[model samples]
Target: MSTDLIFSDATKLAELIRTRAVSPVEVVQAHLDRIGAVNPKLNAIVTVAEGALEAARAAEAAVMAGVALGPLHGVPFSAKDSIDTAGVPTQRGSPIFKGRIPDTDATSVARLKGAGAILLAKTNLPEFSYSTETDNLLTGRANNPWNYDRTPGGSSGGESAAIAAGMSPLGLGTDLAISIRGPAANTGIIGLKATHGRVPMTGIWPRVPRRNWHVGPMARSVRDVAVAYSLLAGADGADGFSTTPLRFDTGVGSSPDQPLRVGWLVEPGFGLIDSEVAATVQKAAEALHGVGCVVEPVRIPALEQENALDIFWRLHRMEVKPAFAAVTAGHEDEMFTISKAMLGEPDTALVDFVRLEQAAERLRDGFAEYFQRYDALLCPVLPIPAHAHGLAEFVINGRTVPATHSLSATVPLNVTGLPGLSIRFGTSRDGLPIGVQLVSRWFAESTILYLASLLETASPVRDLHPDI
Candidate 1:
């Protein structure tokens, strides 16, 4: 097959299939071929859906026979191992979940299948979906396609790596912090932590207590993320927050052309950001200006909370003990040291959970009030570009940054339960990808996507691809 097949986006592939220009079997086969050639280098995909070949052929026959097609017709995609796929092993990067296969598909899986998209493979993640690097004992670490010595930031690293390498056009990734956005930054792809509660989280693993978790999209293009998010949005009765009637629409994930009020911040919140990181934020803001977005540096007084980050991590740590006790007990040696450290922390106390909840609420309310005056907030996704793995700690902005857990600038948004995005800005001096974040109000996914689509067309990160 011609290499051109690998460049097709989920939307474009669907359109081509709809027009009968390419059969579903052809697309799926091409992706499988790509995976066969590329996955050894990236170690991104853990399991290839055994019978996708037959499934694609069946979809082709139905399309030819005049059957109605779903919006994602013939698109190829992958999911983080945390998402359940019937009869497929979802190890979730841990020995505990090793050899485990789900009897039924998760809501998102069913939705994608119902839309005629082929499940290409299951991507890797951190053990129990913990940590910021996508590696575990079972699938190993997912290396950055750009630089093998570096990591593809986790826990959604495999998904972003797959899309960045063109192995898959789209993917499903769950997020609480930068699990979606951070990998996109490192891999030079695009990811959306869709507004919490906008997309159904019915089937993701470790099922973190409903504080501020989200299951969202990752793709090479912003438009692909939008398409996936739109197809997956609904209030499934199985989910607690899915209380309202199932409402599925575009969910405003696409862009609006009105002049956008963008607040750009590079204060690093709690961690010390890289010196060049702030300059990149400014440059990205300037790029947005050329596209008609009004950019200004804004102060977020809420971020100044002393010990804010420690408290947040403590809360997240507290929740993880229950979620990972079994896995840690069975495979403690296999888990990342940082993740192990989190577990070693005291269990979440009731008062601590309640206090963290209140603090998170305050932060959200303050950020929301501020966003009411701005179209979106722009900032660095990480303090530095894909750094050496297993550092245990590092410095940023020439400051003595102590904690290994404070690198993520995108984590606060997770605490706020808002929609966040990470799009490539440019590359670092060492040739790794650099990126910034775009955050919008809750459930304002379409607006964020629209802005991303506009920025993509204007500046275009499409040319930056890994050597793999």
Candidate 2:
């Protein structure tokens, strides 16, 4: 095995495989070995495709026989347990469907395979993906590889942990609200939640109800993300919300640090921020200032005046609840207690839904106004880095935090369907990785990613693998 492949990006791996310097089977084997070694410790992947290697061997033979390869070519990646893969357990982290397997790979999964990326395993997620920690009755818990005592952060926690610990270079993750961003922030890896309808949501679970969800890439670098996003973006006729993919003129524009405008919101948008989270965000603001961007204290004008969590609940109430309701029918007692506590709560009171819709408009308008003056907004991904495992409550700075939506600073962006990127910015005094999210205008991920790339260059935090 080449020492280079251990942590190499997809771009590098593709080129190596293209040149025949690397075999697809070898590349897949390395990821398989990494999963075998790390999954036992972190529990990131719930189901492994045992025959994945043999498939990779076949792929290698095709490459050797002078066949054209897909963009992903020989790379290995994982899908969240929620995505269907033919002949593989597609358990969404619950015991109800223990032996369940689909007859077809998800549209995204099939497309990726058609393009040549190998499906290595299915990473874990919260049961029915209701909580912020990735623990389910079936797959158990996924720990932060950086600090096992802390959570890797939910729903997409397993995806983030797997990438951070080098179990795989790339993986698929779905973000309804903060699933992708929060876990990436929690585990100190790169995660992006695409603009609403940017990626098709055909084969994913729960999309049959909630239409606001998006699927995107989680990986080590911005370029890796670009490749995944390109492959995943475009209308599939199945996802009606997706606009037909058309030519976007702009590439990733640079000049990372010039005397341009940047917004820094240290306050949790509609929640509270702890000292550590505040400090981490402050440090990022200062770093942006040092890099020549004018950082200013910006406010989310409608945050206090709006109930975004209520909006979140409403969007899910009519669309998502039925699917979740089915899950809670028999196993309500066995489910995460918090999920039961939060589920089936009334989302809107007719008048309240009207008011919340107005509020969403105001919030969107506020960001629209702010973006006219600033390039991007910076905030903490979560009020605190992945809270202590499964505690019913969180205490931040001598204040007892409310359970579900208390840590919700990132949900507003989801409502506006903007682009948010999480990068490893700071760690706690105890060494838990804390991340600051940079949000850009809708469809302008390049701006946020450019800022993140600059941060990566100035203070690189890479290759921090788990001891597991």
Candidate 3:
């Protein structure tokens, strides 16, 4: 019964609790037990919320009293350590701020708790949330539950690992470039990088480059991500960037009035993609077509010309370096590899930075034009499945590229402020998870999320969990 409870998605868990078939205490305790069993092996959860059971007890009392409950009442969710969690430790995977606890919860965390989700734990991340793999001197490294030797992608790596390993049913993860989607793809879970600024970045780190950073949900099912997004996607006044006053719709499994026009791409824009990964993108396109959507292979020339990954690195390094330097000012020795490497890079030249900004505008313009013709874009989440840990470079389709190339497929969405969702659609030749990215125009999270739900139902590898 504990095993079944642990693996159930947040939506199902909420329903079970709502029906009084399960008590809030049982749900929270099952996750706590699961965390105790698997977290030591995965090192995903760094700090367990001491008040979790207390909160659960309160939820149970409410249920017994026949009081109204929120949508996620009694459901346990985790957050990436980079996200502030009130009194809980949010070390940001660095010793510079070790034992740091915030006085207020991040907007994302506060929203989830408002919906009755209990904060269960804080997950790990790369130092200062700035790397492709999850590791830091503060918490060591987060191992993939599928294959301990490989990584669950970074920044959000711990969140993905925790959800995929059934330590938490749903969680919050922040994305900058590839952080959220890459890790979810690595672990066979689903992650949403909602339209930039759709979810407030208040209380998250490194606010200097706030335009590219996003906080969204990572979960085992599409419906849960949609539910979380609906609650999270409004202006929080505190975050200036989150000023979108649009109404959000949790449109899971909903169809449009007409056939949704879709496009898929795997090359000439996203850099070197593995043949297997490329085929998976094609397969996803075929599946969408099979489901009565108009799908075709397409490409955007600006993406190929601007190179979103290059633009992201050039712009963010200049913008974020000072923030890191200031935070690590006297505690240089406490910095880890990812943060140190980021600090080591020289600042973007004034002329080059201006050009990159212009280039980013062009990329966004290009996506705007493409979306006029297509409702959604399908692409590979990563060039390859989760690779072995500590890789500095990767060889894909007979071409060797820097490790940063992994950001190619994802950074474009960040550059354009577009919405994207990562869902497992295929298994790699080596038995690893391969995810496809679904993208839509700005503030159209409902479209991509609805499309993801369709693909989730049509997915060949749906509901497959790691044998941890």
Candidate 4:
């Protein structure tokens, strides 16, 4: 029962708890035991919340009293280290912020707790949550559960790994570029990147530029993602940029009556993608087509321009670099290699920064125009599957590219402030998981969710899990 509990999705776990099939204390303890068994090798969970069992006991009492329960009542969830969890240490995968404990929970974390979800632990990530891989001087690398020699994808790698290994049924991860979806793809789980600002950035570390930063849910099933997203969406007053209201009908959207116009691209007018990944994306498109989606091959001319990656890099380097410079000045040696490089770079001139911002706006406009013709765009989440640990480069379509280009297909969505969701579709030749992202216009998460539902149902890879 404990092993079965570890592999269950949050929604199912919630139901079991609500029906008195499992006590909250039992659910929490099952996950704690799973974490203790698997976390040493994966290093996915950086810090376990101090009073998880105590919280679970209170939840069980509420259940026994026949009190009305929230949707996630007693379902255990993990949070990316960047998210504050009151008593838990949110080290942000860095020594600079070591032992940092916030008195208040992040808006998303608070909302999840309000929904009766138990916060079990904090997951690891790259230092300052800045890198594409989940390895830091503070917490060791979060290895892929499927293949320990490979990366899980970052900076949400820890959260993804935890979900994959059954350490937590659901978790929260932030995506500036591909942090959420990339790791999900690598780890064979579901990750949603809500439209920027839809989920508040309050109580999260190093608040990047508002238009690119987004918080979303990660879980094993689409329904779990939907359940968590409903609670996570909505603006918190602390984040001025999160003023947009979230409007999504999971029940209706999950089973849309009308056929959807889903535009999919394998190359995506950017970096090279492995043949296996390209094929899996095609399979996803076909699965959507089989489920009444009018899948078509399409390209976004604006994304073909070389400036997409440049625009993303420039904005991040210009804004996030300065924000962390003060803390990193004398502590360069303590920071991760990527963090040092990011902070050490010279600042961009005002004119150059403005030009980059304008370019990004144009890119966003292009996606807006494309979305008018299609309900959502489906593309490979990452150009390649999980790669070797400590890898600095990858071979894509016979060409060597810097590993950072993995963000090419994903960062554009962040630039456009659009929503995207990655769902596992197939497996690589090496048996690594292959997933694709369904991207939608800003605030059109429901459309993507609808398309993802179709793919999730049709894909044979849904029940596949890594053996520890």
Off by over 4 Å in 3: 246-257
Q: In model 3, what are the clashing residue pairs, if there are any?
A: none
| Structure candidate 2, residue pairs in collision | 132-154
> Ten residues in a row with the worst lDDT in model 4?
248-257
TM-score of 1: 0.93
Query: lDDT (CA) for every model shown?
Result: 0.79, 0.79, 0.91, 0.88
TM-score of each model, in listed order: 0.93, 0.92, 0.98, 0.97
lDDT of 1 by residue, 296-349 (tens): 888777776634555568787777677777656766777766568777777777
Backbone atom clashes (below 3 Å) for every candidate: 8, 1, 0, 0
lDDT of 2 at 70: 89
TM-score, predicted candidate 4 vs. hidden true structure: 0.97
lDDT of 2 at 229: 77
lDDT of 3 by residue, 114-229 (tens): 99999999999999888989999999999999999999999799999999999999999999998999999999999999888889999998767798999999999999999998
Give the Å shift of residue 340 in candidate 1: 3.3
Top candidate, metric lDDT: 3
